[model samples]
Target: MRCGIQSFFFLTLGGAETLLLTSMAYDCYVAICRPLHCHVRMGRRLCVLMVTGSWVMGSINSCALSIPYCQFRAINHFFCDVPTMVTLACMDTRVYDYMVFLSTILFFVLPLFGIVCSYSQVLLVVYRMSSAEGRWKTYSTCSAHLTVVTFYYSPFTYTYLQL
Candidate 1:
C-alpha cells in the first residue's frame, strides 16, 4: 500500500510538473519563434486546456502505474519509485522495466525533447537577427527558464536512464 501510494504520487506529481515544464517551453517557443502568431495560436483557452489535460494525463498515468504495485513489497532503493520498486519485486521485472522506460520516454523524454527543440528554434531566430544586442535581448527572455530546465531535467534524465 505504501509502495502504491509512492508510485501514485510520483506518477501524478511528476507528470504534472513535467507537462507544466513542457508547456512553458512551448510558451517560449511560440513567444520567440512566432511572436505575431503567439497570441492567436496560444490563447487563454488553449492554456487552460493544456493545463487541464496535463492533470488528467497525470491522474490517468498514476492509476495505470499504481495498479501494478497494489500488493505491498520491499523497495531496494532509498526512494519509492517504479525503478526501485521494480528492482525489489520478487517477480521477473524485465517487462515492467521496459514499460517504465516507455512511460518515462513519454512522460519525461518527450518533454525534454520538446524543450530542446523549442530552445533550438529560439536560438535560430535570435541568430537570424542582425544585431548582437537583439540576440542578447531575445536570449535574456529564455535564460532563466532554460536554467531551471537544465537543473530539473538533468537529474530526471539521469534517474530514469540510470534505472
Candidate 2:
C-alpha cells in the first residue's frame, strides 16, 4: 500500500514537471521570438490555466496508471514506479510498457524537440539583427534557458538512451 501510494505521488510529480517544463519552454520561445505579441499571448489567465491544466493532466495520468497496481506491493527498487511496479506485478505488462514508451515520447521527446526548435528560431532571429549590443543581449538571455535545458536533458538522454 505504502509503495503504491508513494509511486503514485512520484508519477504525478514527474508528469506535472514534464508538462511544466514544456510550457515554460514555449513561454520562453514566445517571449523571445515574438516580443511584440508576447504580452497578449502569454496573459495572466492563460498562464494560470496552463498551470492548472498541467496539474490536472498529471493527476489523471497518475490515477490511471497507479490504480491497477494496488494489489502488487513488492517494489524492486528503493521506490515505487511504473517500471518497478510492472516488474513486480504478476501479469502481462506489454500494454503498460507501450504506454510508458508513448508517454516518454509525448512528455519527454516532444517537449525537448519543441524547446530545441523554439530556440533555433529564436537564434535565427537574433542572428539577423544588426546591432552588436542587441544581439549580445538576446544571446545572453537565451544562454540561461539553454544552459538549464542542456543540463536537465543531457543526463536524462544518456541514462535512458545510451547504447
User: What are the per-residue Cα lDDT tens digits for candidate 2 across 67-134?
Assistant: 46436365557665555556655667787767766666666788788787888888888888889998
The model with the greatest TM-score is 1
Q: What is the C-alpha lDDT of each candidate?
A: 0.74, 0.67
Give the clashing pairs for model 1. none
Scored by lDDT, model 1 comes in at 0.74
Which residue segments of model 2 deviate by more than 4 Å?
Answer: 60-78, 159-163
Name the TM-score of candidate 2: 0.78
lDDT value, residue 89 of candidate 1: 60
Candidate 1 per-residue C-alpha lDDT over 21-80 given as tens digits, one digit per residue, 9 for 90 to 100: 888888988887888887787788877876675666455444334345446666566656
Candidate 1: lDDT of 29? 88
For model 2, give the RMSD to the true fold: 3.1
Judged by lDDT, which candidate is best? 1
